[model samples]
Target chain A: MIQLLRTLGHLTVDGVWQVGFATRFLFAMLRHSGPSFARFSLTIRELYFSGVLSLVIIVVSGAFVGMVLGLQGYDTLQRFGSESALGSIVALSLLRELGPVVAALLFASRAGSAVTAEIGLMKATEQLTAMDMMAVNPIARVVAPRFWGGVLSMPLLAAIFSTVGVIGGWFIGVVVIGVDNGTFWSQMANSVDFREDVVNGVVKSFVFGWAVSLIAVFQGYDCTPTAEGVSRAITKTVVYSSLMVLALDFILTSFMYIGK
Target chain B: MNRAILDLWVGAFVALGFAALMFLAMQVANVSEEGTRGETITLRARFEDIGGLKVKAPVKSAGVVVGRVAAIRFDPQTYQAEVEMKVSAAYPFPKDTIASILTSGLLGEQYVGLAAGADSEMLKDGDRIEMTQSALVLEKLIGQFLFNKAAEGGSK
Candidate 1:
């Protein structure tokens, strides 16, 4: 029992150390990212890999989610004889909740995992060490662009998610279900507050981007220089990021909405 | 060749994203009040209690939004809440239009509903709406219900 307790204590210390290391790494990446974003080629390449590639999945999923919201919202609102509220229902749900949350989850799982895996591969192949030998900082060259690319990508991805989702919802709710398009659009405009719903959602995605990117790059940078280790790091990136996105969403929602 | 193509697509993607965000801000958010149904004139009304009434709450007349609540202030002298509204000039009301805080559903968003009254004169900028109603405080109703229950228990 004492041995078990000692092991648990050691794990706790290691966990705290890892968190501190990641925080420092994130700051270093941020510092490196400054002015270095002028090296547009590297950042743009990372952006294309992370952001542009993530677009198809984000848009497709966004449309599907919006369609589901429309169908569900219409069914629920119909009972109240207030089917006119279908637009507001779908719009608010996507803008306030699902758009940021789901897009971030997808971004983390898709691009974030890719980042970790790529970095892990580089580490395993000793390419990072080779760069280090040549008077090159691996973090500046490697980590910063990926980090900045992610931070920039998240809010835009979320916006696309919301816009596509809203349009998709409109397609189903109006075109398919025969709900009035004017009522759909106008009610959405009327009820969905700009600051409360839209701005906060964008803010949420921006923060999520910071978190997921930090996790992805850190995991990659610190992964054991082995094939199995790289695979495990990818898994960790997905699991921890998804958990953090959800947990952070709760905290942010409380601060933004409920505290007011 | 690939780099140029990638840059173009990236540029297009970013623009698409910004456009979507702008749409959300403009259409869904009500962020830019400029050109929001034409010019607006500021007006004020005094209420006993504001409840959950917030700034930017729609001011509707006959179920059509004519303005938004711009600001709220507490008049310590009268212990009343002063609500300032920015009514669209296109939807100006008569001088005697009654502004009441009406809630949607059982307990939902509160908006200022203006009922047109019999008056030849039209309300102008900086006009103080004379007839005003305060928002019903839901907490008070719940407190009253609990208080009655406690009173009945005491009597029993």
Candidate 2:
């Protein structure tokens, strides 16, 4: 009994301490991020590494997801004799929930894990120490650029995902399923409000981007400098950022849909 | 690998991202025409029971959408629901038009249907529609039907 209680206490203290340290580290990173913007090419290079490389997966998955939504939505709506509404259903689902969330999850595994691994390796190799000794702030030179790159690319990737998904839904619903083309398009246009649905979705993606990027950089910077430590940090980056994206998505959706 | 080539790829990526956003705003959503709806005239109507009528619900006439419900307010003194709507200026209506709460399908959204009446004057902005019909509540309808049936059996 005593051993169990001690273990519990130790976990509680460690968790609290980690949260506090992460918060302070975030503030330090922001305070030292001026050079990331001043010398913008560093950020651009990271963006290319993270954003451009991840396009194929995001787009292909978007198309497949959309086609599945179309097929499922058609089967369900056909019961009510309202299959023309398939377009609206698919678009709304993609924009409001699936696009930002799934893209962020894929991003966590692909780009986010890569970022953590790279930073963790840099720490393990003493490059960060060399930079520190050379009178250069490692946070500004390395971490901040990658952080900004992930943040900027996330929303754009989500947007592309949703757009491609919508097109894929259209092709399946209209061409393959034989729903009236005009009705499908018109119903979608009528139902989806620019301000309420589209803009809100963009806002969700932006918040997700900010969160996932912060968690990735923070984990990488805080990991121990060793082979096992770098691998562990990469795992934490994917797991923690995925959970953060899902939890934040639920909170945002509740706030957006409360009045309705 | 080179700086110039990397810059070009990054620029292209940014451009593609913006283009996707543009497609979402214009094609997938109704962003472009939201602002270009042209001139509109506001009108008000009073109802005893508005039912599930909501703001932005379509107002139809002759099986076509002519306007949208703009606002709904409840009056404490008279115990009535006052609904405000915006009608397109191109579709002019007479002063004695009838506004009725309607449902599109069996389990679909509620809207307001306008039926024109013979009158010399056309409705202007801020005009009040006098001939209004309340929405048909399902519970009330069932209750009425049961009561009538019981009454008929009692008479027999």
Candidate 3:
């Protein structure tokens, strides 16, 4: 009983400590990321590495999800004799929820994990310490660029994902399913509110981007600098970022749909 | 050399992303055309119940959209919901046109539908459409149906 209580207390203390450490580290990273063109190249490189590389998967998955939504939406709407509304259903689902959530999950597993693994490997190799010893601020040189890159790319990736998904949905619903093209497009255009769906969805993805990137960079920066530690950080980046995106999505969606 | 390549890719990536967003805002959201559209005439109508009617819901005439609901409010004196809408200047209606709030489908958004009348003078900006119909509330209809059935049973 005493041992169990002690373990519980230890876990609580460690959790609190980790939260504090992560916040401080995030602030440091943000402080380093200022309006300076000095490290612009570094930021650009990181953006390319993260954003451009992630595009293929984001686009492919978005299209697939959209096609699936179109098929399922058509099937369901057919039951109500309202197959004309397939476009609106598919678009709303993609714009409001699935597009951002799925893209963020893929990003966490792909670019976020890559970021964590790369930074963890650097730490394990003592490169970060070497840079620190050589009169360099490692956070400014190493972490800030990746942080900004991830943040900037996230919303963009999500937009592309949703756009392609809408197109894919159109193709599937109109071409293969033989739904009235005019009705499908017109219903969606007439119904989906810009402020309520698209803008809010962008805002959600932006917040998710910031959160997932922060988690990735923080995990890497504080890794134990061992092989096991690096691997664990990579796994944690994927799992933690995915959970954070979903949790934040739920909170934001509730605020958007009800709190307003 | 590699930096330029990276910069180009990043710029292109950002551009594509912004383009997608622009499509959503302009085409899908139809946000940009809200109030700034060159020629539009504002109109208002009163209803007994708005019934899920919202701002920006399309105003249609003869199954075609002519405008959108601009604002909605309730009047204390008459206790009716006042809806302000903007119709396209090109599709102006007569002074005696009848406006009705209608739902697109069984479960869909509510919109204002205008039926033209024989009045020669067309409605201009800030016109009040006197002839108006309120929305059909499904719940109220069902409740009345059930009540009538119970009353018939009682009589029998």
Candidate 4:
């Protein structure tokens, strides 16, 4: 048991260092490439794929989440005779945390896993080896596109999630549950701030995108040239990226609120 | 080749769908307009605490939004939160309107609720609201209730 604990500690330390090294490597690659307008195009393509493509899922999920929040929040607020507070709760929760975090998690599950799997399959097929043999930088070709795509898509997806959530909340809270329309909108408008909460959510989405891409690329790049290895890489990318998004969220929230 | 083309079309459709969703959301959030609609009047309130209060938060009378919270600052002399609110021209306010920092629910968001007085003098744009109330924090209220309950229990 003691020996196992030591091994686990060593592995954790090693993993942390590896993550640090990978981040440095990614930044270094970004810096080395000269005036890469091509990267911007790649980012746009990624934005379309990650942001635009994920709309249906995001809207569907957002609607359900907003409805649930209304149902729960309204019921709770009714006890205090303050059911009008439903708008504020939905808007605050969606804009502040749920919208960005849930969207990122969904993106990681859907697109992040796909990115890892595709790259892993390419590696397994020795296509990456062929690029190296031709003296081509695989990082630029493979890692850059996927990374930029994830980064660009994250904020757009987050925006969609927040919007859908608010609308859903409105439908459930005002229309279905019978909170007054004027009260619901007025409460939402009075409670949420564009600069503080909305901007904060957008900023967090960007960070989430970067983290998601990094994890996906790292796992994909490290995959062994085997079928099982590709599957394992895909699994690890989703699990690790989701955990990282949640961890970073807590850290950012703490930093934002701790001293103030 | 056919499969690839089909995939590309599907991708394009997906992208368009997202764009439409964003457009609709932007409309709902009212992202286009910077200033409030219609004519505006101003009111002021002082509070001990204004948690998560933002500049764009709506200023309301009854349940209808008349304007938005224009600015929030701390008074150097009083060490209290000074909140400036804007009201729309559509609703005429009495001179003796009372403003309170109100919550939506037990543990919910804070907003400024206005109650107009019987006085006939209509408040103009940028006029200060003299009467004000601060937010009632749940934790403090709960603590007070518990302490009171405990004291009563002990006495009994």
Using TM-score as the measure, the top candidate is 2
Error of 2 at A67 (Å): 0.9
What CAPRI class is candidate 1? Answer: medium
Which candidate achieves the best DockQ against the true structure? Answer: 2
For candidate 1, the per-residue lDDT at A257 reads: 90
Model 1: per-residue lDDT, tens digit, A1-260?
Answer: 99999999999999999999998887888778753477878788888889999999999999999999999999999998888999999999999889999999999999999999999999999999999899888888888888888988899999999999999999999999999988988888888887789889999999999999999999999999999999999999999999999999999999999995
- Candidate 4 chain A, which ten residues in sequence have the lowest lDDT sum? A32-41
- DockQ per candidate, 2 decimals: 0.55, 0.76, 0.68, 0.12
The docking quality of candidate 2, as DockQ, is 0.76
- For A1-260, candidate 3 gives per-residue lDDT tens digits of 99999999999999899999999998888788873237588888888888999999999999999999988898898998989888789889989999889999999988999999999999999999999999888899889999989998999999999999998999999998899888887778766788889988999999999999999999998998999999999988998899899999999999998784
Candidate 4 structure quality by residue, lDDT tens digits, B17-58:
456345433443444342457677777778778766766666
TM per prediction: 0.85, 0.90, 0.87, 0.70
Rank the models by DockQ, top first: 2, 3, 1, 4
- Better lDDT candidate (2, 3): 2
Each model's interface RMSD (Å)?
A: 1.3, 0.9, 1.0, 5.0
Kindly report which residue stretches of model 4 are placed more than 4 angstroms away from their true locations once superposed: A32-36, A39-45, A257-259, B1-156
Candidate 3 per-residue lDDT, tens place, B48-142, comes to 99899988788888887778888999999999999999888877689999999999879888989999999999898898999999999999989
TM-score of chain A of each: 0.97, 0.97, 0.97, 0.92
